[model samples]
Target: MRLISRLNPAEGVGDFWAYIRRPQPYRWPILGLSMLMTGTLLFWVLQERYYLPPERPQVTYITTFAPGRTDEEIIASNIANEARKDALAAEQAERDEIRREIYRTFGRAAGMDVEKIEREAAAERAREEAAEKARREALIGESIAEPAE
Candidate 1:
């Protein structure tokens, strides 16, 4: 279009420079605000790149099955895997408990009410567990109900 062809970078640049040169009472404040906005925008845009950790690669668990495997062998393998997972989970929980006890000991020595904090944490965990149980029960009830004809 003729309108688009008439637009020139030289004219825009000159106008911008003219505006910047023109003295106004609020010019400094406006410039400060603009700089602040630019800095904030740059920070917001680059935060994940600089502040946060890099993304982790996806984990893949490979299970190789032979050409012909017996049902008992498969079942035993599954049971063993489940038992191993459970043991690892239990070990992790124990380690966490031990760490918490150490922290509580240090906190008490520092005159902090670790016992009160522990009690509050325990109550919150109980509430979360109860909620999870309710949700599980609701899902189970839905699955058990017969479909209407």
Candidate 2:
């Protein structure tokens, strides 16, 4: 019973209310400082957890060259680099295709028109590309047009 009385939040709130009701010279300042501190802490936590952009993985390109390397060796190295890059691109394409297939399977399972969705996406891409091409041509024409003298 003693422990429960001591630990009761209502009693604690009553005591706090009595203390706050008493005359105090620094009460306003204390309240303001506490509010500011609380706001700063809340903002810091929210910014750290939600507002900050996620860090992306860095891409590092590695290349090797030496003064003593012959022309043939340099050419072979260039060819190997190109082949590796092409292989990576092909692997990425395969992964993308597999991912699309999985998405299509899920969409079909959910009774979605997967083919219609794909066609719409393709049409959207085409429209965007056309708009971009038109914008580029307009800019080029403006640049090439003779200025009014």
For all the candidates, what are their Cα RMSDs to the real structure? 17.0, 19.2
User: For each candidate, how many residue pairs have backbone atoms clashing (under 3 Å)?
Assistant: 0, 0
Candidate 2 lDDT over 1-67, as tens digits, reads 9988778899889999999899999988998999999999999888744476878989887656676
Per-residue lDDT tens digits for candidate 1, residues 1-149, read: 88876886888999988998898889889999999999999999888644677789899877588848999999999999999999999999999999998999999999999989989989999999999978987877644375734
Instruction: Give candidate 2 regions above 4 Å deviation.
Output: 1-63, 135-149
Looking at candidate 2, what is the lDDT of residue 109? 98
Considering summed lDDT, which 10 consecutive residues are worst modelled in model 2? 140-149
| Candidate models: Cα lDDT each | 0.89, 0.91
TM-score of each predicted structure versus truth: 0.46, 0.46
| Root-mean-square deviation of candidate 2 | 19.2
The 10-residue segment with the lowest total lDDT in model 1? 140-149
